[model samples]
Target: MLYQLNQLRDLSSLFTRKEVKRWLKDDFKSIDIKLERYNLHKKNKGSNYLKFLKETYKILEENYPNEYILKNEFLNKWLKSELGNQNSLIINEFRTGKAIADLAMFNGVSKAFEIKTILDKEYRLSNQISEYKKIFNELYIIIPKIQINKYINYDDCIGIITYDSEVKNFELIKKAVKNEEIDSNTLIEILHTKEYLEIVYKYYGHLPEMSVFTQYEVCKNLLSKIPNQELNSLFLQIIKKRKVNNLFFNKVNNEFNQICLSLNLKDSEKNELIKKLKTNIN
Candidate 1:
C-alpha cells in the first residue's frame, strides 16, 4: 500500500509531499492507527514507514520520469541554483487574465514556464501563449526531450527547455527572447482586488470613486494611466513584499521559499530532498 501511494504520486502529474502525507495519514487511519500514534512515531524519529516513503520516492524518481512533476522539480532546483537568495516570487498556476501560467517567477524580470509533456497537446498552446504575453516579459515552453521537436516553433515561445534525465537538470535548448511588451492591463489584473486599489491609491493618492460593480473596470483603467516602466517598478515592489506565511513541504512547491521563511524544518526538508536528489543524479 505504501509503494502504491508513491506510484500514484508520479502518475498524478502534479503530486506534492504535502498531499502524500495526507494520503498516508488517511491510509494509517483506515488501518486503525491513531493520528496521535503516528505523530508520536515521527516525534520519536524511528519511523520505519517514514524512511520507507523516502526510499520509495527516491527509487521511483531514479527509474521513472513523471513528465511534469520531475520537470517542475528540476526547474525549481535550477532556479534556486541560478537565482540563489535574490528577492523573488515563484507562483504555480499563476493566473493572468483568463489564462493560467504553469509556473511563474518575479524578480529582475517577470517570466513564465509553460510545460508540455509527451502526452500534452499543442491544441490550446496558441491561446495560452497569447494570454501569457499579456503580462510576462519572458515566456518559455518546458517540454520533455521527446516533445522538443514538436514545440520548437509551436507559437512565439521565448525559449524551450528540456529535462536531461541523465544529468537530472533542465537544459535550455533555446534562449528566450526578452519581451519588450509589459501589458499594464494584464499586470493590474493579476493583482488582488485590494492590491489593485492599493496600487492605485499609492500612485494617484486616492481611490477612483465608482459603484461597487464598476470598481474593477475603473481600477484597471486608472492603473493603465501609469507609464509601463513605473507600473512595472511598483508591481515588483508589491510582489516582493508579499508575506510568506504559508507552509510548503515541497521544495519545488512554488511557495517553497516564502513558507521556508516561517518554517525552518521546511528548509531542512528541502535541503535534504535536494541532497538526495543530487546523490541520485550523480
Candidate 2:
C-alpha cells in the first residue's frame, strides 16, 4: 500500500520546480510520458491541461496525498482564513539557519509551520523545531491525527494542528505562543548579500567600506550589534519585498494556488501559465 502511494506521489512531478520552469517556457512535451503512463492524456470533453492537472490533483488528494498536497491545503485554507490578512505572503520551503521551514507566512509578523505526514519520521523534527524557534515569532507543527499523541506533550510554545482527511481541513489542536527571542544571525542568514547590505545602509545611514571578499563578514559584524527585535522586523520587511503574484495568486483556480505561489512566478510567466493551462490536451 505504501509503495502504491509512493508511486502515486510521482504525479506531483508535474509541479516540481524544474517542470514548472519548463512549463513557463512552453516546454510541454517533457511531461508526455508520465501523462500517458497515467492515462491522463486521453481526450476528454471540455478538458484542457489545467483541468487535466486539477483532475490529477484530485486523484492524489483522494489517494496518496503527500507533503506538497498538505502544503497546498494549508496555503489554500489559511491564506484567507481568519489567520491570514490582506498583506499576507505565503512562502514555501523558507530557509532559516540549518532548517527549511515547510511553510512560512509573512503578514504582520513571521510565522513558521512544519508539517509531518504519516510517511514521515520524527528523528529530525526536534532539530528542525529548535532551528525554527530561533527565527520565527510563532511556530506550529502540523501532523496527522494518528500522530497527535506523539507530539502533544512537546514544548508549550509549539502549537499542534491536525489534518482531517475526510473533510480535508486543518484544525488547531494547540495555539502557539509568540516567541520573542529572535536570533539575529540566523535571521541574517536568510538574506542575500545585497539585501543584508541594504538593511545595513537603511539602519546605519551608510555602509562601511570593505572588499567583496570581506564585505559579508563586515556586514555580519555590523548587523549583530542591532537589537534582535528590530532586526527581526527588518528581516520581515526584506523578505516581504520578494515578488509573489498577488493578482494571479488570489485570482487563479484553487487547484493552481499552491504551485502558483510556490513558483514565485513573474507577471509574464503567470500570464504564460494561464494560457498554457488553457491549451487543450489531445
Candidate 3:
C-alpha cells in the first residue's frame, strides 16, 4: 500500500501535457477514480480525501495548463483556439536556452507572453520576465485580477491580462524591467530573502505530514527553489522524525539522488551522499 502511495505521489507531479497523456494511456486513473469514490462517501474521511484531490488538481492546473487540458475537453478546445497556428501566436516555443515561454507572439515585431494561471501578490514572475526581455522586443505576464495588487505598476513591459468566464483581455502596462533590470544574482538574492523563503518554508516545511502524493507535489515546487544541500537536509529531518517509513523514504531519496546525478553531480559525490544517507537510516 505504501509503495502504491509513493507511486501515486510521483505520478501526480507529471505535469506536462505529454506526460499526462502517457499517464492516461497507461491505465493510471486511480487518483481520479478514488477522488470520485470519496466524493460519494458520506464519511468525513471521504470528504477530506475529496478536498485533497481538489487542491491537488487545482495546483496541477495552475502550474501546467497544457496538462490540465488532458482531463477536461473544454479546456483543450479553448487552449487550441487561443494558441492555434495563427501567424499572430506561437505556442510552446523554447524562447531562451533555460526557459520555455508558454506562448510567444510575433505580431510584426517579437512579443513574448508567459501565461501563469495563479498569481501570488508577493511572488514576482522573475524568471519569465527575464527570459521574455532577453528574447523578445516586448513581454507580458498574463494573470488573473486576484493578483493585480501583487504588482505595483503594470504599465511598462509587465502587463496583466485578466480572464473572464469566456475570453481574455490583454492590458498594455508600463515596462516592469527598466534599462538597469534586475540581474540574475540580484534575482537569486531576492528569492532567498527572508520574505520569500518564509513563504516557501511555510508551504513546504510541514510537507511530511501530508500524504505521499502531497509531499511529492510540495517537493516538486521546492526543488525549483531550494538547493540540493537544503533538500538533503530536509529529507534527513523527515527521516529522523519517522514521518515516512523506510520504504517510502528510500523511494523519494532515490528520486532525489537520480535528479542530482542528472545534474552532473560527480559519481564520487553521489556515492558518498547515498552512503551517508543509508548509514544514517540504518
Candidate 4:
C-alpha cells in the first residue's frame, strides 16, 4: 500500500514548476486578497505556519492512509461526477479526506498521491518537493492545465494532473512538460484572463452600475507597485463608458481634487478635463 501510495505521488508530480509558475502569474490576482494576505502571513510567521501545514498533512496521512489527495482534487472530482455521487462523496467521505483512489488506479495497480493548491513564492511547492521525494518516488502537483509546461523535467515525473473544468489541451500540457523552461508571467496572464473578462462582462451593459470608486481606489493603491502608464490605461479603459452616478461622480471628484492639491494642476486644468469627459458622455 505504501508503494502504491508512492506511485500515485510520483505520477502527480508531473506538474512542472514552469506550469505552476504560469498558473500563478495569470490567476494569482483573482484569488481573494484576504486569503492571500493570510497565506502570506502564515508563510512569514515561519515555524508556526509550518507546524499548521504539517498538522494538515498528518491528518491526511492518518485518515486516508493509502488514498491521500489534495482538497482541490476532491472538489474537482466531486463537481465532475454525477450529482448523486457528488452528494454521497461529500457527505460520507470528502470532508473526512478519504476516498478510494479510483482515478489513480490503472488495471489493478494503485498509486500514492499528494495534492497542492495556491502556489506562491513563500509557500511554493519547491520547498515541499524534496520532502515529497523522500516519501514517494512519484509526486504530483495538481494545477490548472494551462500551466503544465511550467513543470521542469515533467517527462521524468509520473504525470501532470488538472481540474476537469480547465480548458487547456491535454496534449499541450504533455508537450509543455517536456520543455526545459516555463515562463511564469505568461502563465499568470492566462490564468487571470477569465477573471478580468468576468469583471468586464459584469459592467458591459450597466456601466453606470460600475464601481468606479472601487476601481479608482484599487488603482491608486496599486499605482506605486505597477507601471504607471499601464495602470492608467487599464483604469481608463474599464471606466471610460461608465456613467457618473453619485458614487462615481463623488469618487472622481474627490480624486480630481486630491490630484489637483497634490500636483501642479490648476483648477482650470482640472475643470477642462472634467468638461471634456462630460462632453464626450453627452
* TM-scores for every predicted model: 0.70, 0.87, 0.37, 0.23
In the range 177-219, model 3's lDDT, one tens digit per residue, is: 3222213222233222333334356546743354544644444
Candidate 1 residue-wise lDDT, 104-186, digit = tens: 77887788878776557788888888898888778888777767778887665478888766666777788778776668778
Tens digit of lDDT per residue, candidate 4, span 64-107? 32222333333333322411221121111101012222222111
Point out the worst 10-residue segment of candidate 4 by lDDT. 87-96
TM-score head-to-head 2 vs 3, winner: 2
Candidate 2 residue-wise lDDT, 1-282, digit = tens: 233655586777776677777777777775666767755566543477777777777877877667878878777775467477778877778898889998888887788999998889989988998999988998999998878999998778898989877788888999899987877677668888888998899889999999999988888888889887778778788888887664324545666666766777666766778788777666
Candidate 4 stretches with Cα past 4 Å from truth are 1-112, 116-119, 152-155, 164-282
Preferred candidate (lDDT higher): 1 or 3: 1
Lowest summed lDDT across 10 adjacent residues in model 2 is found at 245-254
Candidate 1 TM-score, true structure as reference: 0.70
Q: Give the local distance difference test score of model 4.
A: 0.31
Better structure of 1 and 3 per TM-score: 1
- 168: Cα error in model 4, Å: 10
Report the candidate with higher lDDT, 3 versus 4: 3
Q: How accurate is candidate 1 locally (lDDT)?
A: 0.61
Ordered list by TM-score, greatest first: 2, 1, 3, 4
Whichever of 1 and 2 has more lDDT, that candidate is: 2
lDDT of each: 0.61, 0.78, 0.40, 0.31
Error of 4 at 183 (Å): 34
